[model samples]
Target: MDWDDLRIFLAVARTESLSGAGRRLAMDASTVGRRIARLEAAVGAALFLKTPQGYALTAEGARLVAPSEAAELAATAASEAVRAEAGITGQLRIGAPDGCANYLLPQVARDLCDAHPGLEVQIVALPRVVNLTRREADMAIAVSPPDTGRLMVQRLVDYQLHLAGHRDYLARHPPLRDLADLKGHRMISYIPDMIFDRELDYLSATGMEVAQISSNSVAVQMQAVRAGAGLGIVHDFAIPFAPGLQRILTDRIALRRSFWLIRHADDRASRRLSLLADALAQGIRAEVLRLEGLLGPCPVRGT
Candidate 1:
């Protein structure tokens, strides 16, 4: 019946662990546990089932999530109404690929924090798609949009990638005048079979040799490229950060892709969520343009 109890319950539900929820709420594990127990007593149903992995939500817990979120939103709205000028406040966890998490999201986070000092942002750098259904993140940035789910998808921005190499490697290797010249040289890329997205499986289609150095992570691939591992397709926004990295065959080979901002459909009515989402989209769009522009005009453009 109490909003505080529902708040704690929701935190535990999302984190799937008392300690994690405690950390987020600035309370200790024992306190979170007691609060959850109290919530269960009030509802007359066990909400979480303990497991080796932590707490797994029971069927009743799954059902409680929606109404609990609705209550949380109402409480937040009431709080915001009293402090209308302070801006939206609360923590938000965003799931994104390492490429964006490491390079792009930081910029967005910085801007958002500067604008709204009370806001907190958590970046969950996951190699796989973030599951909104399980509440893996409050929101996610995905390379592809999902057709099935109770979700709201927004096209955040379009970005480009190109085969690139470190200046040191370029100096030692034979000149890369065209795609044909890429055949004999080594490459740094994702493991072909481990490629999670069809969009990421294009290294083979480039007529280049198989990857000599591989990782599932874009951040790792970027590091390998900078360490002179081999040629890798890298985000344009990321290229400027790697001091010696330069696009290879930019005119002949460029991959254009889009980033989508995804949210649970149930959050569609939350004004606080909308505010945060708008800031995220705008910040990402601006930062991508700024970073990519550091290299001057590219032969390709975003769709």
Candidate 2:
């Protein structure tokens, strides 16, 4: 069977009109009709019944439509498998929460590139989850398991968050001295909607009110902390203090969070992605544990 004609038939079956299918496929109605007719002739069955209103799929057409869709999926899988067998030798785009990429990717990427000379890696620091449906990225490192349907998610490691401030800020403010002092302190916050719950819970428990210095980017927030605008909350590993930054609450008393590696369900077999995913998982696990140990383990559970 002519695959082009079958594709046209599938489009028409989905749209139920030659004109509609043509618009979708960027072809003319006549071209769509001809292709559909050719496909029907090759199949030895009437694929559609043309009525004044529109095209209606014949029983045979309905049956072929689903299998055709499945065939397309199978074809995509086969192509990815072929690429995987060819080895990790192409650009791999990894989308991640800004902090994760900053804290973990540098070493991981260096090692991967050194090990696989042919593989190139691009790390994108995204504020929100990249849309897998749109292929915004080949894979990702995320804080939470992404929407489950049609995604491949791997829980890499769980980590914790700490409230940190500049030593100078504390010195001038006379050191929080007690949780009660945070009530009037300035705070640099990440994206509000995705703010880790422990951040909020800590404030409530401590009888403090946060003054928000809102930032959308994690790198910006870290810089803000160094500039001494306010105390900022960040993953323990990402904070780069310049001899002045100090952990306000020991990790033992801080909020804990988890991280995951993810990829589009369809791109599971992309060779570059597979290698990158494994590298990221190992890199994150090692780095996060090292940082957590340095900062002191969180007293919180399931950390």
Per-candidate TM-score against the hidden true structure? 0.88, 0.66
Top candidate on lDDT is 1
lDDT accuracy of residue 302 in candidate 2: 14
State how far residue 122 of model 1 sits from its true place (Å): 2.8
Q: Lowest summed-lDDT stretch of 10 residues in model 2?
A: 197-206
TM-score of 2: 0.66
Model 2 per-residue lDDT at 253: 41
Model 1, 22-108: lDDT tens per residue? Answer: 987899999999999999999999999999999999999999988998997788668767876767777889999889999999989
Question: Which residue pairs show backbone clashes in model 1?
Answer: none
Report the Cα lDDT for residue 62, model 2: 82
Worst 10 residues of 1 by lDDT: 294-303
After superposition, candidate 1 runs with Cα above 4 Å error: 297-303
1-303: candidate 2 lDDT, tens digit per residue: 766676677677767798888875779999988887788778899989988878988899889976776665566566667776566676777888777777778777888888778787888887777766535567877777865568888989887667777767776674465555566678776555655433233334334454477666777888888888888766677754344666765523467778878777766655545656887788779977776677543433211
